[model samples]
Target: MFMRAGLTIGEFSQITHLSVKMLRRYHEVGLLEPDRVDESTGYRYYSTAQVPNAQVIHRFRELDMPVREIKAILATPEPEARSALISEHLRRLERQLDTTRAAVTSLRRLLGPASPPLQVELRTSAAQSTAAVQAMVDQEEILRWYDGAMTELDAALADACLSQSGPPGGLYDNALFTHERGSATVYVPVTATAPAIGRVRPFVVPAAELAVTVHHGPHDDIDVTYGALGTYVAEHALAVAGPVRETYLVGPPDTADESAWRTEIGWPVFRTGIRVSG
Candidate 1:
């Protein structure tokens, strides 16, 4: 016997514009529940009083809130706490939107009708001692890994009172491009020996002559530039052996706008056309 429960599952679905399957899933996840369940016939019913709650849940779901987070937001008795939780999710959505917009802009440039010519340079870098962090990382996690490693190196350099000699750079093994998983090292050139502690360690980045090219803007379509540069190297018979190097000319700790970022991609090469055996 149900009191004040006139709405059957179908009727409730119609009123809330929520699918029965979704409502059932919400009930299974303990996110929402029916007002009554008939034990004999296995029928479910919702009361009119629960309609507002269901509507709110649907709105939260439309905003892409996870079930557990939605449950927490619903369970918070204080209005301010509930609002804060929703606000946090909104901020995350805003950040995601920004990334999406940047990617869209990058895609347009990459897929545009006119292709731009790449400017490649051959420059030799001298060997330098630096504070660095190295790890075998997945391609998908490289961004997060780089951020963490860079922060650690910066703190270590500051603690040791080491002055930066040049821009921050990274070495990415060929496997990263070919197999999508490989070792990566991020280093900040320091004036003197750095205290090797935790993931931060002393490393000498070997000198090499590189076929260099500047990749302008965000890294979303950086592979295009890499391809062009690699083609240039191949056409000119400048191929050599070593991991690829990336120098962050204008990047984070300098600006947040990806449009303002500038990265220099370098592929190792030899001075003469004679291919030196690796």
Candidate 2:
């Protein structure tokens, strides 16, 4: 019966879809020790009963799970703990997948196809009333800081009994995008600047005649919107010479829904009429 219950490491590896080396490593790590070792020849042997456990471990690792996590999972006696571990890993993977999809979608629309227009025309943006928050954000830390900043901005807006017109915009200095951390103001232009915060100030965005259009989704696709705005400006013979401002019309404050988000993108431009909309 004992002989019938045993299988050589090679046979176990073949059935479990794991390599001999991996089995040896698993044994070394105390994850799966062999059933027996030869005293004189030093050959390793495994029990056929261990096949299912080895298979489960192999499947979890294939899913990119950490070995330590798999170890903890294998130590569990309850089905629920194993299931919870798998669910946590699935959550992480889903977030990674979402970020990847956004990136892929963005690149595909970077349109080198027909080309962008040569120049954009100048336009007046009216003195727009907005509830905004200003901050001397460190450039290197801006993205890292945006979530918290946006939270504060929203809280302030709520206290003021106001609403946003679009997604928030960042007035990023040249350095913030390319070099060290720098100052930025995350703003939502309202009918009036809400009462101020400590140096987190408030200001009315003086409107200019803006070349504007509705961007219908997340900032992940913002470059596409920029391309659209760029083409619009060039087709009309305009040159952009000012900060890019985005006014969020619908987003977190009204709802945490992405589909309902809308932004009006504005680029100041001046044109010579010798424009090429690429």
Could you say which candidate leads in TM-score? Answer: 1
Report the lDDT tens digits of candidate 2 across residue range 61-176: 88888888889998988999889988999877776676688778788766447543423334566665555555566643555477676777777877888776655675554455
Candidate 1 stretches greater than 4 Å from native:
25-33, 39-41, 48-60, 63-103, 256-258, 274-278
The digit string of per-residue lDDT tens for model 1 on 1-278 reads 75564688899999998999998898898888888888897788888888999999999889898999999998999999999999999977876776687578667877898776777777888998999999999976787799899999988988888999999999999998789999999999888887888899999999999988889887777877887888878877888878999999998678988779999999998777544221
CA deviation > 4 Å runs, candidate 2: 1-7, 25-42, 46-56, 66-92, 107-121, 126-152, 163-167, 173-176, 179-185, 190-220, 227-243, 250-262, 267-278
The lDDT for every candidate, in the order shown, is 0.87, 0.70
Ten contiguous residues with the weakest lDDT in model 2: 114-123
Candidate 1 clashing pairs, residues 3+ apart or interchain? none
* Deviation (Å) of 48 in candidate 2: 7.2
